[model samples]
Target: MKKYDLLIKNGVVVTTTDMYACDVAVKDGKIAAMELNMDEAEAEKVCDVNGKLVLPGALDVHTHLQMPFGGTVSADSYLSGTRAAACGGVTTIFDYPVQHAGETILGLVNSKKEILEQDACVDYAMHCCITNLNDGEILEEMEQAVAEGITSFKCFLVYKKEGMMVDDATLARLLIRAKELGAMINVHAENPDLIDLNIEKFLKEGKTSAWYHYLSRPEFVEAEADKRAVHWAKHLDAPLYIVHMADKEGLEACIEAKRQGAEVYVETCPQYLEFTCDVYKREDGRNFVCSPPIKGQESQDALWQAIKAGLIDTVATDHCPFQSYEKDWGKDDFTKIPNGCAGVENLYPYMLDAANTGKISFQRVVALCATTPAKIFGCDNKGSLVVGKDADIVIYDKDKDFTITLDSMHSDYDHTIWEGKQLHGYPVQTYLRGQLVYDNGEFVGKPGMGQYIKRSPKK
Candidate 1:
C-alpha cells in the first residue's frame, strides 16, 4: 500500500518563516506531512517539481463580485471572479455582501446566498455590510450573524447620498455590538463630509478631469477619517480593520494605533502601488479610475515601505471591475465613474515579480499573500503547509518570465491597467481542498465545488 494518497517532491517549500526543499504529502484533503527527500516509490501519485516554489494557496480577504454601483453592475460575478482568482493562484476569497438602501440586513444575506447558489469556483466567505441600519433591530441581526459564523461586518463612512454611509453614533453602536460579540469591524474609511465638500468645490471650478478625481479626495481627507475611526474604535474597545490604506498619513495612523495597543489591521491593493493620480489623466485613464482614488507617487512609495516594515498586513485586490462600455459611466463627470478595477487575476503575478526583483523576500511574499490573510480572516486550517492545514497549495515556477497581456488573462474586461508590465513568476498549477482546479491555464474543476465557508469569529 502507498504511504500517502499524493506526494509533491523536490520543490522549494515556503511558509510564513522558512523556505526550503521538501516533499509534501496529502491525504483526505489535509496536509499529512512535510518531508525532505521522501522516496517517491512510497506514494500513489507523485509530481516531480524540481525547480518550482511550493507555497500555501493565497487568500484574498477583500473583493467585490457582481457588485451594483454607479447605476450598473461590476462585470465579474462570483463564478467569474473566483475563476480569475484561481487562475492567479488564489484558493480562497472573502467577498462582501452588499446592501442596498432600504433593505434589511437579513434580506441582503439571503439575497447573496441565492446569487451564490448557482456558481462559485473557489471557496468563499462573506463580510456583511451594514446598510439600512435600523433602530437596534439590525443590531440583533448582526448578533445572530455572529452566531452563524459570519465573523466580520463592513460599514462605510462615505456615499452620503446613497444612504450607505453610517453616521458616527450609528457606527459607535454597531462597533459596540460587534465588539461584544467578538467579531471584527471592517471600515471603508474615507471622510464623507470632506469628500462631499471637495467634490462641490472642484465641480464648481470645472475641474472634472480624471486627474481631478484624486485631487477631489485628497490624502488629508483619508488621514483625518482614519484617525477618527481609530479613536472611535479605541473608545468602544472594538477591534477595527481599515480597508485599503491609501497614504502616508493613513499608514502612520494605523501603525501608531497598533503601538498604542489597538487592534487595527490594514490592507492595500495593487492599483495603489502600480498606478497613481497620473493614471486618471491618461487618454484611457477613465478605465482605471477607482474611489478613494490612487494617491500620488510619494504615497505609493510610502505604502511599499509600510508593507516591508510590517505595518500593512494584506495585499488584496479591491477588484471591482466595469466593462469597457462602462468606462464612460463617468463621462463629462469624474465622480460618476464606478470606483474599481479588476486585479484578482493579476495580484499574484505582480507580487511574485516584486519578489523576483528583490523588492520583497520569498518568505515575506508568502506571509503577505497567504498566511496573514488566513489568520486575520479566521480561516481555520487554510493558510500554511503544516501537517493539519488544508491542502490549498500552488506550484509556481520561479524561473519563468512573462509579460502581462490582455490576451492571456481570463477576466471579462476588455483592457488591462497593467498593459506591457513584466512578471517573472506565476502559478503552473493551483489546488483547492486537494483537488486541481487550474492547471496550465486550463480549468479542471466545475462550478459549485466552491462552497460558502462559514468562518468562525475572531480569536
Candidate 2:
C-alpha cells in the first residue's frame, strides 16, 4: 500500500557479498523496499531489467582527479573523471588529497576543497597524503582530518628525495597515529633506496627506454617494501591498506600478514590484471608507464589466481591520466614520466571481461570492484543494493559489445592504454540515487551536484 519513486522489477540483484532475485523499490532517493513481486502501479518509474545483472553502483577508492604531478597536471578533472566513472558503472570515487612540499595539512585540504566543490559530478571522498610527518604540528592535524571524516592517510615508502616519501621512522610514527585515531594507513610501497640505486644504474647504462622503468623497480623491490610495510604495520598494530598490489609476491605478504593478525588489505588495479610488463616494454610502452610498473606475465597470472583464492581484496582504477605528449614526459628520463594510467571508464567492463572469460564470478567482480571498496572505505550506505540504502545502481548489459576508443571515452587524456581493446559487457545505464547520470556513453548530470562523502568512525 506504499507508493515508490521507481521500481526495478524481476532482476537478479547483486550486492558485494550476496545475490537475490527481487523487485527493488525506490522512493525519495533511497531504497524503500525489495520484494519478490511489486506491482508497477506503485511506482512512478519502472525499468525492465529482463534478467540483466542489477548491481550496486561501484566505488573507485583510488583515483587522481585533476591531480598535479611531475610538473604537469593529470588530464581528468572531477567533471571529466567522475563522468567517465559513472559511464563505467561507478557511482562513487575517492580521490587523493596530495600535499605539496611546505603546505599544511589543513591548507592542502582547503585546496582540494576548491577543486571538488567546483567540479565533481558523482559522489566522492578523499585520502589525505602525509608529505611531512616529521613536524609535530602537522602530525597533530592528521587527527583533526580523521575527525573530519578523512578516515585514511597515504604514505609513500619510496621517492624519498622527492619529499613525498616517508622514511621508516616517520612511517612507524604515522602508523601509530593511524592506530590511535582508528584511521587506515594507505601505503605506496616501493623501496626508495633500491629504486634510486637501480634508476641511477640504469641511467648510467643509458637505458632510458620505457621498459627500463619496469626493470628499475622489479617485483623484488615491491615485495621487499610490501614485507617491510606489513612488518611495520604489525609492529605498530596499525590498520594498513596497501595500494596497487602488482604481483603474487606482494599478495603473499598481505596474506601472510593478515593470517598473522595484521590488519592489512590489498587493492590491485585493472592494468595489473589486464596488461603486463610486455605491454610496457613494447613500442607502445610509454603509454602504459605507472609507478610500481606493471610486472611480468607470470605475476599477472598470479594476481588473477590470488583473486580467485581470496588473497586479493579489491580492484580500483588508480585513474591517473596525462596527455599523449605528456605521457612522454619521462622520455627524457623514465622517472620523470608521471605515474598512472587511464581506466575510470574501463574498470568494471575490463573486470567483466575477466568474469566472462571464467577468471572470476559476477558476484566476485562486484565484490572487488564495488562492494569491498565501499565497505573498506566506510561508504556503508552506497555500496550495496539493499532496501533503505541509496538507490545508486547500474544496469549491466551482458550482451553489449564495444571496442574502446579514446573518441568515445571522457578522460582529458587524448589516449588510453586500453585504446584498442574490446570489451564484452558494459553498463547500459547508470543511476545515482534514482537519477540517470550516464546513458549511451554520455553524462546527463551537471557538475557540483555530487556530494562530498565523509567516512564514519571505523569499527
Candidate 3:
C-alpha cells in the first residue's frame, strides 16, 4: 500500500511562526508527515513545488456570500464564492447566516448548511447574525448554536433602517450571554444615529454623490461605536470582535481597550488597507460603496502599522459584491447603492503581494490571514501546515506577477474594485484537504466538495 496519498516536495514551508524548506506528505485528507527530505516512491502522487512557498490556505472569516442586502442579493452564491476563494488560495470561509425576524439561529444555520452542501466548493463554517432578538428566544438559541459549532454571533450597530441594527441594550445582552455560552460576539461598529444625521444633512444639502458615503460615516462615527462596544465588553468582561475595522480612531479605541485588559479582537478588510476614500472620488466611486466606507490615507497607514504591531488580529475580505448596475442605483443618491465589493478572489494575493514587496513579513501574512483567524474563530483543524492538521495548503510562486482583472477572477461579479492593480505574488496551486481545488489560474474543484466545519468554542 502507498504510504501517502500525495507528496509535495522541494518547497519552502511557511507557518505562522516559522519558515523552512521541507517536503510534506498527505494521507486521508490530512497532513501525514513533513521531512527535510522524503522518498517520492512511497506516495501515490508526487507534486514537485520546487522554489515555491508552501503555506496554509487562508481563511476568510468575514464573508457575506448569497446575502440579501439593499433590495438585491450579493452576486456570488456559495459555489461561485467558494470557487473564487479557492482560486485565491483560501480553503475555508466563515460565512454569515443572518437570522431574520421569523427564523431561529439553528434554522438559519441549517438552511445555510443545506445550500452550502449543495454549492460550496471549499470548507466552510458560519457566524450567525442575530437581527431579531425575538424577546430573548434568539438568545436562548445561541447556546444551541454554539453547541452545534457555530461559536460566534454577529450584530450590527448601524443599519437601523434595514432592521439589522441592534440597540445598546441588545448589544450588552448579547455580550453577556455570549460570554456565558463561551461564544464570541462580533460587531459591525458604526454609530447609526450619527450616520443617519450625516446622511440627512448630505441629502438635504444635495451632497448625494459617492463621496457622501464616506462623508456620512466619518472616522468618529465608527470610533464612537467602537469605543462604546469596547466599553460594554470591558464592563461585562466579555470577548468582543470588531469586524471590518477601518479608521484610525477606531483602531486606537481597540488598542486602548486591549491595554485595559479587554478581550478585543480587531479585523480589517483589504479594501481599508489598500484603498482610501480617494477611490470614491473616481467616476466609478459608487462601486466602492460599502458600509464603514473606505477612510482617508491616514487611516489606511494606521491599519498597516496596526498589522505590523500585531494589534490587528485578522484580515478578512468582507467578500460581498453586487453587480455594477446595483451600484448604479445610488449613482445620484449614495443611500440607494448596495454596499460591498468583490474581494474573496483578491484577499490572499493582495496580502501575499504585500509580503513579497517587503511591506510585511511572510510569517505575518500567514498569521493574519490564516493562523489567527482559525485560532480566534475555533477552527481547530485549520490554520497551519503542521503534521496531522488538515492539508489545506497553498503553493505560491513569489516571483509570479499577476494583474487584478475581472476576466482572471472566478467570482460572479462583472467588475472588481481591484481591477488593474498589480500583484507581485500569486498562489500557483491550492489544496483543500489533500485535494487540489485550484491549480495554475483555474478552479479545478467542483461544487459540493466542501464539508461543513463544526468549530469549537472560543478560548
User: Highest TM-score among the candidates is held by which one?
Assistant: 3
Cα error, candidate 3, residue 196 (Å): 1.1
Query: Who wins the lDDT comparison?
Result: 3
What pairs collide in candidate 2? 330-337
Candidate 3 lDDT, tens digit per residue, 1-459?
999999999999998778899999999999999997899999999999987999999999999999999999999999999999999999999899788898999988898899999999999999998888888898888888899999999999988998999999999999999999889999999999999899999999999999999999989999999999999999999999999999999899899989888899999999999899999999999999998899999999999999999999999999999999999999999999999998998998999999999999999999999999999989999999989899999999999999989999999998999999999989999999999999999999989999999999865
| Per-residue alpha-carbon lDDT of candidate 1 for residues 1-459, written as tens digits (9 for 90 to 100) | 887778999888988788899999888888888989888888788888886999898888888998888888888888888888888888888888766556666677767777676777788888988876666677887878877768898989888888788888988988898888888889988888878888899999988877777887889888888898999998788999999888889888889989999989988988898877887778877888887788888899999998888888899888888887787867778887777888988887788778888998878878888898888878887878889988888999988887788887777777777778888877888888778898877777677877677777876
Alpha-carbon runs more than 4 Å astray in model 2: none
Off by over 4 Å in 1: 1-3
Checking candidate 1 for backbone clashes, the offending pairs are: none
- lDDT rank order: 3, 2, 1
Global Cα lDDT for candidate 2: 0.85
lDDT of 3: 0.93
Predicted candidate 3, C-alpha RMSD: 0.8
Q: State every prediction's TM-score relative to the real structure.
A: 0.97, 0.96, 0.99
Q: What CA root-mean-square deviation does each model show from the true structure?
A: 1.5, 1.6, 0.8
**Residue 36 in candidate 1, Cα distance off native in Å:** 1.5
